[model samples]
Target: MKTIDCLGDMCPIPILKAQKALKLSPSGTTIKVVTDHSCTLESMLNHFKKYEITSTEVINGVWEIFITKS
Candidate 1:
């Protein structure tokens, strides 16, 4: 499990960082991303969907995304 804090970062940075984490993660890795911006969350969610990554969005504005090696 790894945590990525993108609280102050704007769009793309959070997602890009998450992508990098995923690339380096082993199978069944869980990456928790914290972002204050809803748009960034939405973009990240949409981007994850394209790769079929499993994710859960909490009410507190936290996005928990799970990446598994294919």
Candidate 2:
């Protein structure tokens, strides 16, 4: 699993990074996205509908979103 740290990033930055990772990585790769903004989480959840969301957990106001490439 690879981790994309978007703790301070906003909007398309995180999504863009994820998209780049997906494009570069092979299929079935698992990624963990760490974000502190709700909007980022929401955007990811909505944008990554095509991928498999392994899990989402909010701890101490930070969200950890896990997705597996299909």
Candidate 3:
């Protein structure tokens, strides 16, 4: 698993970072994204939906999105 910390990053930064991580990660790899922005999560959901990846909230207050690359 790869971990990405996007805390305090606004808007598209988190989403963009997630995208980069996904591209760099191998197939079937799991990437963990930590962010405080809700909009980032929404955008991530939309972006990963095509890959059928799901994001899980691991911690409260801060959002932890888990993406498994297919």
Candidate maximizing TM-score? 2
Once fitted onto the true fold, the runs of candidate 2 whose alpha carbons sit more than 4 angstroms away are none
Winner by TM-score between candidate 3 and candidate 2: 2
Alpha-carbon shift of residue 13 in model 1 (angstroms): 0.3
Tell me the tens digit of each residue's lDDT in model 3 across 1-70: 8999999999788878888988998898888888888788888888778665556666776888888888
Off by over 4 Å in 1: 50-70
- CA lDDT of every candidate: 0.74, 0.87, 0.82
Tens-place lDDT digits, model 1, residues 1-70: 6888887899889889988988998866677777778787678768886454566676677666554444
TM-score of each: 0.73, 0.89, 0.84
Extract clashing residue pairs from model 2: none
In each prediction, how many residue pairs overlap at the backbone (N, C-alpha, C within less than 3 A)? 0, 0, 0
Candidate 2 residue lDDT tens string, 11-39: 88999999998888899998898998889
Error of 3 at 25 (Å): 1.2
